[model samples]
Target chain A: MPDFDFHVSAFAWVPETSRGWVKCLRPRWAFEEAGFAYRTTRLGPGEGGSDGYRAWQPFGMVPAYDDGRVRLFESGAILLRIGALSDRLRGWDDAEEATIASWVFAALNTFETHTSRLTDGLPGAVEAVSRRLEALEAALGDREWLVERFSVADIAMATVLREIGETAVLRRHAGVSAYLARCLARPAFDRALQAQFADFDDSRVA
Target chain B: MPDFDFHVSAFAWVPETSRGWVKCLRPRWAFEEAGFAYRTTRLGPGEGGSDGYRAWQPFGMVPAYDDGRVRLFESGAILLRIGALSDRLRGWDDAEEATIASWVFAALNTFETHTSRLTDGLPGAVEAVSRRLEALEAALGDREWLVERFSVADIAMATVLREIGETAVLRRHAGVSAYLARCLARPAFDRALQAQFADFDDSRVA
Candidate 1:
């Protein structure tokens, strides 16, 4: 895979609590789903702030992406780029693409905002997340995916939901809990998880 | 105008504090930028929860969009769709499109999450937003827009930044402040603001 043209940047090491949860997994999962061979450019400790890296990722965040075609950062945006390149993950048409993009924002911005706060145990966060989950459950309504088909929206959503998977607040929304299970059960997710952990191990410094 | 193909939904009325800051203004501004004729589907009091409205916008938020081509929610997503539809607001090519999308997420998700908290005076929120604004100021560097040109990404970023327009935290980032000024100075933004306030005035309930 040395010749792999697509590249997604990731952290070589993260704290034990964050090892499996780094956002690089979003693009890594998308690559797996798209069956697109890609490599990870691992940034170790103290390496994220290099002027060059900041040029690629202004916030110096993980999961900056580049292919010969384009270079960009933000896991949600990286997922969209991969979606554009892969038919299986993209909307079947313009209208469907709009729906997919909507869910992407919903997952990353609308839902993640509350869920991340809940993860941090911020005061009043539970109520915010519960309200969102109720809306999500209704929106899901027996659907296995956030849209008509499994797309990058689910990838963004599943990753965000994973932040709260252990919480009693999440357990209360049976429908949403089931949806998260269906998303996480995908083979691509497993591969993405394994690859991220392996990177953490292989890139560990002495 | 009665037969305009594009429709952007807006709240018919809002409290005085929220009159000009509604999310619907995002799409309204985009429509103005594209010079596309569009009508507002005004949602009156308690109208957001109607089953049909919920179907269009799962979270019952304002600014759900419907054109003959596609119908969707999420202001960020709606802006992307408008960018796709209007040449002036889209990228020159695929690579540029990816950059625009990245900044859109950067604004809506990354920056908004922190800035919104800072606006609410959440404890420790200022520090979080300050760090992001510094990075953003560095990123803006001499650029007038987040991407190569004025696009929906700027729309998203500008609106989020407006949340903290009055804060000393924002005033400290001179580069970012200038960049935001350039975005707000656009004639489309003024039109969007006028339309939103006028709607609030006309739609007031007895």
Candidate 2:
């Protein structure tokens, strides 16, 4: 056990829902795979409030992490930290490691940037995101996963794609859709989704 | 020392010239500080055509890095990797490291987003960016730097802010202007800027 608890500041519904969900989910799965005992603290809408959260995160964003030794705010950085703790997410070699890191950024910065803009109500956002999806599908053409096997990059990207999966835009992209299915089928992802959604609905009702 | 040479794809310009310029300058300084040999492959101006440098980067963006180990894209990710190579940039401890990492994202995603929009030539973009500059000025007020001392976050932000600093809108923020001045004073920054601009006139003449 690493003797660390992860605290995530997130909202149930927002443009960043998928990212927030993944932040709460991936570490828990990795920790479980490592057989490490860890707890998660989920902040509610009014519980942390805007000012409180922004003070902790100047960007006023959610999915911040507080490991026993350090507090990390970016999901990518948190994911990288978690990946460092175990061999399951990172590669054994330097070249592989750099590739994994590049894909991680591509997932969040390149792909998600365009995807989020689509969902955020920009002009022709849907069309733009559809083109990006086609690009991703082409990138993933025959591969079951992005890198070697199912790594953190897959986890991070699938989580982001889940937001758009509900739309008709992604329906045409069979490879990406199948990849997402493979990701969600994992027991840990399922459990985490349940827990996250349960808390999400609880907040809405509250 | 690390058995690596950095090949960066960027344009030649002053720090305050634009977002792309600032992004390229910061990590160039970091590499210089690390005593690494590097080459800048400049792109010519077009949607994705920059002086015939398009093939070097997949996304056709400035500041893509190619080390002997692997090619890495995205300015934020590149900065994180370079900062990780040394203890000087990571901070005194893990806690400081996490804090600094969080602020790096804040600068790129939050502050830089607004500032980029302000310079994007849209209506009200100037005012929108000015407001962000004021908030950044307030955040940076009286602080010699963002973290325990001058760190990668400061370097990343100084580069990004340099673009906004060139505009009349951002120039009105005294604190930010002063911060930019302080950043330019560093010898590493001077060398990086000189290197980036060394071939500017020649390329223009050609």
Candidate 3:
């Protein structure tokens, strides 16, 4: 119900590739699913010059959000703000919410660090992702999801995992592969993926 | 007020050289200042081993905090939770608060990265810190503090800067040096420094 606008740096979405794709695409999916009205703008690369996408982010990054009142830059911060605005994302109690917050930080700061290295063509990308995947597998041991039922933590991690979904590291983990399927089963996530990626495929062929 | 207890694993207050001295020391300081009862535990290097700290944090990092209700890691998240509980740290308004949040991320992710490299005895530490110092100096030009008034962002950055306070990089910027002094002027910060480093001076003789 709260008015929101997001400005993202434009990229040809590869369904799994691109620098800011996961950050730019996922929250939009979550917001629309929560039945919130929001507008999105994609700024071309270097369109804003030195300011770049920082017009939307003081820190000069993409995936910035403005809710008419507060403008937030960090992707994790923006996701937290959106979760606070919607009942669909947060957990039932403060403890659950705090736990989810821990996982969110872990997903980005810990897990995603390995993921970033993997994507950046670093030497140890495969080994690093393998270690993280093993950890995620152990954490998910015999469980369907990270916490009880589905929550924002799942969304956050899934977005990152989706980046390396095609890699052998994730495919080898039966639980993680199954979890990815469950995340995509959500009609909201499916729709967002299709809409966001459709233009990229079209551009590539042209 | 939230009927919570904080269990903090920290180094025994030395004086100035405690790792995570600022973060681990501040909440306790705030709690004591607020008349809240809490428990403190000390963990020494090589005493707990790898699994010890990593159990609380996958990164094997320090200054992890656990409330009876919910366990939270990451200083930024801990600070946000503490700020929400009390208004002592939030800035003048929502925008200012948002600015404070960006600075918190910037300090840790951007400024601290360069500062850490500078302190880590790397080959290019000096050049890296010098470049970052110039950038920060320009950003802080003519401003007394990061924002109009002091907030937690200042606390976070001041603590990070303490790691390299004695470096020539900081010495080169008169404004940054003055800014750090202003942060240290707070009685709370002074007590934190004392609690953190009092033992280090004696250890030198040992």
State which candidate has the highest TM-score: 1
lDDT: the better of candidates 1 and 3:
1
List each candidate's DockQ score: 0.84, 0.38, 0.33
TM-score of chain B of each: 0.95, 0.77, 0.77
Q: In candidate 3, how many Å is residue B96 off? A: 3.3
The positional error of residue A114 in candidate 2, measured at the CA in angstroms, is 2.6
Q: Please report, in order, the local distance difference test score of every candidate based on alpha carbons.
A: 0.88, 0.67, 0.65
Question: Candidate 2 docking category?
Answer: acceptable
Q: How do the residues A69-93 of candidate 2 rate in per-residue lDDT, one tens digit apiece? A: 7888767767777776666667777
Q: Pull out the clashing pairs in model 2.
A: A9-A63, B16-B162, B43-B50, B43-B51, B44-B50, B44-B51
TM-score of 1: 0.96
Give me the runs in candidate 1 sitting further than 4 Å from their true place: A1-4, A201-204, B1-4, B201-204
| Per-residue alpha-carbon lDDT of candidate 1 for residues B1-206, written as tens digits (9 for 90 to 100) | 23448988898888889988999989999999988888889888888988889999998888899987789899988898889889789899988898888999999888988887888788788998998999999988888888888999999999999889989999998998888888899999999999898877453688
- Candidate 1 per-residue lDDT, tens place, A1-206, comes to 23448998888878788888999999999999999998889898777898989999998888899997789889888888888888789888887788888888999889988887887788889999998999999999978898788999999999999899989999999999999999999999999999999888443676
* Model 2 TM-score (B-chain only): 0.77
Count of residue pairs whose backbone atoms collide, per candidate:
0, 6, 8
The positional error of residue B146 in candidate 3, measured at the CA in angstroms, is 3.6
Considering the two chains of model 3, state its CAPRI-style docking category.
acceptable
